[model samples]
Target chain A: MTYQSRYAWSVLFRLFHWAFALSIVTLVVTGLYVNSPWTNTVLEGSRSFPMATMRYLHFLAGFIFASAVAVRLYLWLFGNRQEKFWDSAPITPRNIRNLFSTMAYYTYLTDRHETRLGHNALAGTVYLATIVLTLIQLVSGFYMLYPESVFWQKWGVALFETQQQARFIHHLLMWYFIIFAFFHLYIVIWNDIKSPEGLISSIFCGRKFHRSSS
Target chain B: MTRHLDKSHFEPKLSRRGFIKGCTIAAAALGLSDEMVPRLVEAAASAQKPPVLWLHFQECTGCTEALLRASHPDVGRLILDMISLDYHETVMAPSGNQAEKSFKDTLEKYSGKFICVVEGAVPTKDGGIYCKIGGRTALEIIREAAPKAAAVIAIGTCASYGGVQAASPNPTGAKGAGDVLGMPVVNIPGCPPNPIAFLGTLLHFLTFKRLPELDQIGRPLFAYGRKNHDQCERRAHFDEGRFVEQFGDSNHMKGYCLYKVGCKGPETFANCPAVRFNDVDVWPVSAGHGCVGCTEPNFWDTHSPFYERLPGVKIPGTGGIVHDVDSAGKKILGIAAAAAGIHAAVGIGKRIVKGRGKSDEDV
Candidate 1:
C-alpha cells in the first residue's frame, strides 16, 4: 500500500498525549470525592471500600501524569532540534500576539493560522498552565496522601501542617480544575466539530482524519 | 385512688400515681430502665403547662405536620394540655374570624405571658403582600405578637431563613421573622425542623424562663453546635476518603461515605447525624445518602447538589482538613503565590550574580 506521512506529531508525543488524557479522565472521576460531601452516613457494608483506595487511585493517576510531563520535557531536550521548543509555544511577544490570533482564528472570529509545530501559542500557554497546575496538585496532594513519607510530611507540615489547611488547598484546586476542564473541553469540541478533521480520535488513536486531499 | 376527685370528670383521667406508673412502663419501652423513669415522672408531675401560641404565615404548614408526628407523645400531649395551647390554627377547632379572634384574645389576656411559636417566613417585600391573613400582613402579625411574647420562636427554615421559597430570585423578598420583624427570633431551622427540637426549645424556655444558648445565627446551640460531619458515623470513611461513586453501586451498597458526590455535612453544622430523623438514629446520610445540610444557612443555595461538600472554612495555618469556603479559596490561591515566590527567588538570585559580575569587572 502506498502511504504518505506528513508529520503532525512524533510517536513519543502521541504516547504522552494519550496516556495523559487517560490519566486526566481517571483523575476527574476520582476527583469528585477529593473534598467529599456527606456526613453521618451509615452503610450496611460499605466498609470494604475506603478513602485509601480513592487516594491511591489519585496518586497512581498523578504518577502517570508526572510521567507524561517527564516525557514531554525529555522530548523538548532530546527530540529533533528542528522541532524547536520556542518556535511554536514560547511566550515571547510574538507568540503572545499569536495567542490572541489563534483564539480568534479558531472561533471564526478571525482567519489566520501561523506556521506551527505541535501546539499553537494559545494551546501552548494553556498546556503549560495545565502542567503547572497539575504539578501543584501533585505536590499538595502527595503531601496530604502520604503524610508519613518523611520528606512530604516534613515539607507539608512546614507549609501547611493542619489537616484542615491541606484540605482547603486540595478542595479549592478541584473547583479551579473543573472550570479549566469545562473550557478545555469546549475548545476541544470546537476544534473537533468545526474542523473537517475529527480532533479527538487523533489524540486517542494517533491519527487525525483530514478533509484536505493528500 | 384518684388524687383529684374534686371533679367527677377527673376520676377516670387517672390520678398522678397511676400516671407515673404508666410513664414508668413507657420509659422502660424506650430503653430507659425503671430508675430513669422518675425524671420523666418528675417532669410530668411538675404540672408545667407552658402557654404556646402557634402562629402561621406564608408556608405549606409542614411544620405543623411535623409537630403532629412528634416522637414523644407525652411531650406533645403535655405541651397541648398541661400548657395552655392558647392558639393554633390547624389544630384549633375554631376557624376564620374566630380563630384569629382567639389569637387577639390571647394577646390581650395573656399579654407578655404566652410563648409565640411562629411558623414560616414573613414576606417583607412590597408591604408584605406575599402572605396575608385576616386582611393583615404576616409581617404585621409577627410584629404584634412577638414583643408581648415571653419567648418568640421561629419554627422551620422558612421562619428561620425563608427556606426554599426564599431561595435566589425571591420574588416576594421573604425573610426570616428575625430579619423582617427586627427581633431576635429563636430560629429552629430545618426543612421542617425536627419537632422534638421545637419541644426541646420550648422546654428550655419554660424551665429556665429564657432561651437555650444560641449559635451566632440565634439558633439553639444545643441543636446547631456540632457539624453533621463531626457527629457522622461515616466520618472515618471521609478521613480515609472512601466515597460512593454512584447510587446503588457496590460502594453505596457497602455503605461508603457519600462525601465525594457532594455531601455537605463536613461544612454544615447540625445535629442530624447524632439525633437523626423521626426519633430514629437514621438520618439522610445514615440512610446511605449524603447530607443536604438542611439545617445550615442558605442550605438550599449554599449547600446543594445533595452530594457535593461546601467550600472549606478558614483555619489558623489552614490545616489539610478544613471545610470552610473562604479558607479553601485562600489555599488554592496559594498556588499562584508559590509560583510567584519561585519566580521571584530565581530573578533575585540571577540579579545578585549579575551584580557580582559587574562589581568584579569594575575591580
Candidate 2:
C-alpha cells in the first residue's frame, strides 16, 4: 500500500484552533469558579480580589475565544477549497448517505469504509453545529457581561429577555462542549491508531497521509 | 376638603422641620447632590402638590406597609402631604361607594395632572375577574385611569413583573402595569420595594418635572443601578469563598457570603445593601438570610429553592422535574465517559480481530 502526504490545514487554521481550544479551556475553568467558587483559600494580607480577578480572566479569555471563532468563520467563508465553508456542508443527499455509513462503521455494522480527506460527513455536521453553539455562547456571554449597557439593554434584552436565561444557556452549552471534547479526543486518537492517516498530527503539521491507490 | 391648602397648612402630622429633614435625607438617598437638598424640600413644599392615585389589585399590600414603616417617623405624613394622595384604598377612611366616589372624583379633578401608583399585578384572564375594585376589573380600571395620568409608577414586584401571582401556570394571566398599559412605567420592584426608592423617584419627578432615568425594566437607575452583590457588605467574604454551607451553620453565624446557601445577590440588581430596609442596618443578607431576588422579573418562579446556589432548570413537559446545573452537567459527563469507555473497548476488539486476521493470512 502506497501513501501520499497531502497538505490538509492552513497555518491560520491551526493557530486559530489552538487559540480557541486554550481560551475555551480557560473559560470553562474560570467560568465555573466564577459561578461557584469552591476554593476557600484566603491569601491573608494580600488584599487581592480573587473572584474579581477570576472574572476578569474569564472575560478576557471569552474575548479571545470569540475572536478566534470569528476568524475561523471568516476563513471558512473565503479560504482555499480544503478550508472552505463548503467542506462542512452536510445537507446534500450524498452527504446524508455518507453520514449514515459513517455511523454504521463506528457502530461496527460495516466492514468496509469510505476514504476521504478533511472531515467526514458526521464530523462536518458536528462542526457546523459547534459553530452555531459558539455563536450563541458569545452573544449570551456579552449580554450578561454588559446587561446595563444601552446597546445590550435595547437589543440583547429583547432577544434573550433576561440575564438568567442567557446564563442558563451559556452554562448548559459549557457541558455540551465538555462532552463534545471527550468524544472528539477519543475519535481523533482512535482514527490515528486504526488508520495510517496521522489524524492527530495532521492538526498540528497541516499534513495527512492518504492511500494513493484506490 | 381643603384642596388649595398651602404647604405650611398641609399634613399637620408632619412638622415643617421634620419634613425638611426627611427631604434632605431622601435627597441624599436618591443619589442627588447636596445642592439638590433645597430643591427636594422646595418640591415637597410646593403648593401645586402633584395628585397621586394609588391603585390596588391582586396584591398583599406589602408595599403600602413598607412605606408606612419608613425609617423617618414623619415620612408617611411627608409623602402624603407632598403628593396630594387623592385616593388610596388601603389608607383611605372611606370604603364601598364613598371610596369609589373619591377615586372617580380625584380622577376628574386631576385629569392628566395626577401620578398613577400601581401596587399590584393586573390580571387579564377571564375578563380580569381575579381582582375587582368597586365592581370594576383591574384591567378595566387601569385602562380607564393609566392613560389619563401624567406619570405611572408600578411600586412593587407585583406591579413591576407580575410578582408571585404570575408564577408558573399563572391562571389569572397577571401582567405588570407596563405590559397591560402598553406604555413605559417607572417600576420600583421588590417583594416590598424600599420606600426610599419610591420616595426618591417621586421627588426626582416633582423636582425635575420629568421621569427619572430608568433601566430596561423601567426601574429608576439611581436606586436599581447596581447589583445587590456589588454593594453587599459580605462581598469580601464572597471573594474569599467563605460561604455559608447551610442556614444557621458556623459560616452563617460568622456572617460569611451566602452564595452557597442560595443567595441571589450576584444575579439580582438592586440597592438593598446600600439602603437597608426600614432605615435600620439590616437587609436579608445582613439578617442571615439569602436574597430571594425579589426585584427581578418572575423571581418567584425563576429564583426559587432559596437554599440552592442556582435555580434548577425545568425541562419543558417534564412535569416540573427540575435539574440543577451541576446535576445536569454531571449526567452529561457521566454518559460521555460511559460512551467513551464502551467505544474504547469496541475499538480495541476491532483492532485485535484485524490483527489476528492479518496474521492468519500471513501464515
Candidate 3:
C-alpha cells in the first residue's frame, strides 16, 4: 500500500475554523466574567468601568463570532464538495448509513475504522449540532444586545419569552461549546495518533493522508 | 371656578397654580411635550369625567393603596375627580346591595363609555371559587363587566399577568384580567404600580379619547417601555461594576449597583427609578434593596430566589429539580469531561489490544 496526500481544506475554511475557535474562546471567557465578574479593580466610582469594558468586549467578540458563523454557513452552501452541508452532514440516506458505520467504529463494534477524505459522518453530525448551537447563541446574543430594536424584539426576543430567558439560553449554550471543545480536542488528537492521517495538522495545513492500493 | 368640585374628591388646597403644575407633571409622565400641558389642563378642567368601575379579585389592594398615596397631582383626589369612580369596592361609601347596584348601574348606564379598572387576578379553577364578590366570582364579574367597558385597564401585576397568585403551583389557577376576559387590556404592571403611570394613562385616554401606545405586552409604553436598569440611578455603578455584595455592606451604603445582590432591574421594565413612588425620590434600588422585578410577567416564578443574581434552571431529566446555572454548568461539564475520558480510555485500550498481535494493516 502507498500513502496519498490530499489538499482538503480551503484557505477560507481554515481561516474560518481558527477565527471561530478564537472567538468562542474569547466569548466564553468574557461571557463567564460578564455573568459573574470576579475581578475587582481598585479604582472606585467613575474612574474605571470593568463590567462595561467586559460587556463591550463580549459584544464585540459576539459580532466577530457571528461573522465567522456566517462565513461557515456560506461555505456550507457554496464551497467545495467536502465543505458543503449536504455532502458533509449526515442528512442523506447514504450518509445515515455512514453515520451508523462511524458510530460502530467509535463504540468498538468494528475493528477497522472507515477512512473518509472529509469529515466522517459522526464528526459531521456533531459539527452540524455545533452550527445549530452557534445560531442559537447569535440570535439570543443579538436579541439581548439590542433590546430596543423593534425588529429583534418582535422576532428574536419574542421566541424566548423574556430577556432573562434569552440570556439564560445564551449562557447555557456556552457550556455546550466548552464541553464540545473538550471532546473535540480529545477526539481529534486520538484520531491523529490512532490513524495514519495527521488529523490535527490537517486543519492548519490543508492536507490529509489516505492509504491507496499499490 | 372650582367651587362645584366635591371637597372630598378634589384637593381644596390646590391653587390654580398647583393644578397647572399637576397638569405639567401629567404631561411629562404621559410623554407629552410642554405644548400639550395647556391641552392637559383644559382636558382636566372640562373633559367629561369617564365613568370607571374598579373591581377587586385575588389581590392585596396595594395598587389602591399606592393610588391613594399618590401626592404629585394629589392623584388619589385627582383620579376621583377626573373619573367618576362609580364602583371602587375599597373607597366607595356604599356596601352590600348598594355597591352591587352601583356596579350594575354603571354597567347599564355607561356601557361602552365607562372604563373598567381591574386590580387583581381572577381565579379560573373550579368555577372561580377562590374569590367572590357579592355572590359573583371574579371571573364572572370581569367577564360580564369587561365586555361592556370602553377600555379595560389592569392596574397591577396581579391584574396584568397574575402576579404572585399565579406563581408556580398556582392553586387557585388565578389568571390576569386579560386572560379571564380573553381580550387585550392596557396593563399598568408593578407590584403596586406607580399611581402616576395609572393617572398618566387615564389622562392620556381622557385627553386623546384613545389608549396610549402600548408595548408588545399591552402595557402603556410611557411607563413600561424602558427597563428599570436603563432608568435606574445606580446604572452608572452597574456599568462600573461597583456592586453591593450584600445588604448593609459598605457598597450598599454608598448606593452601588444591586446586580450582585439579585436585583432584577436589568430585566424589569418599569419607570420606577424615574417616576418613583409615594412622591419620594426613592425606589427599591435607591432605598438600598434590589428590584424584585414586579412589573414583568410571571415575575414571582421567573425572578425568585430573589437574593441570587439569576433564577434557578430546572435540570433536564431531573424531574423538575432546579439549580442555579453555575452549579448546573459545572456538573454538566464534569459529566461531559468524564464521558470523554472514558471514551478516550476505551479507544486507547482497543488500540493497544489490536497492536499487541495484529499487523498495523487495519490502521
- How far in Å is the alpha carbon of A198 misplaced in model 3? 2.2
Residue B328 local lDDT, model 1? 55
Provide the TM-score for each candidate, comma-separated: 0.54, 0.91, 0.94
The parts of candidate 3 lying over 4 Å away from their true place are B1-15, B316-320, B356-363
lDDT, candidate 1, B1-363, per-residue tens: 342223523333445654565455335333356776676556545765656788888788988887665443333444454457878888888988888888899899888888898888778889988789888888788889899988889998888888877886788988888887677879998876776566666655654467777765677767775667778998776655556878888788877777667777755557777666554457888898787777755666556546545543436774655456635555555765565456446544654766644321121
| Candidate 3 chain B, poorest ten consecutive residues by summed lDDT | B1-10
DockQ of 1: 0.07
Which digits, one per residue and each the tens of the lDDT, describe model 2 over residues A91-199? 7786788788888877767655666777778888888899899998888898878866777667556766666666777888998888888888988887776566888
Choose the strongest candidate by lDDT.
Answer: 3
Please state the CAPRI-style docking class of candidate 3. medium
Candidate 2 C-alpha lDDT tens digits along B1-363:
342233543445788788887787678778878888999998889999998899999899999999986766566667888888778988888888888888898889889999999999999999899898777899999999999999999999999989998998899999999999999999999989988888888898999999889988888998887879889999888776677777887777888888878888877878899888764667999999999889989777667776765678777898888888878888879988898899889867876877745421121
lDDT tens readout by residue for model 1, A1-214: 1223235556788888778778877776676545443333345345544455665787799789779878877776676532345645655788888888887665444433554434678877776777777666666777655533557645654555332345456666666665566556656765554343546665655455433323
Docking class of 2: acceptable
Off by over 4 Å in 1: A1-33, A36-214, B1-48, B310-363
Task: DockQ each candidate and list the results.
Answer: 0.07, 0.43, 0.54
The residue-level lDDT of candidate 2 at B202 comes to 87
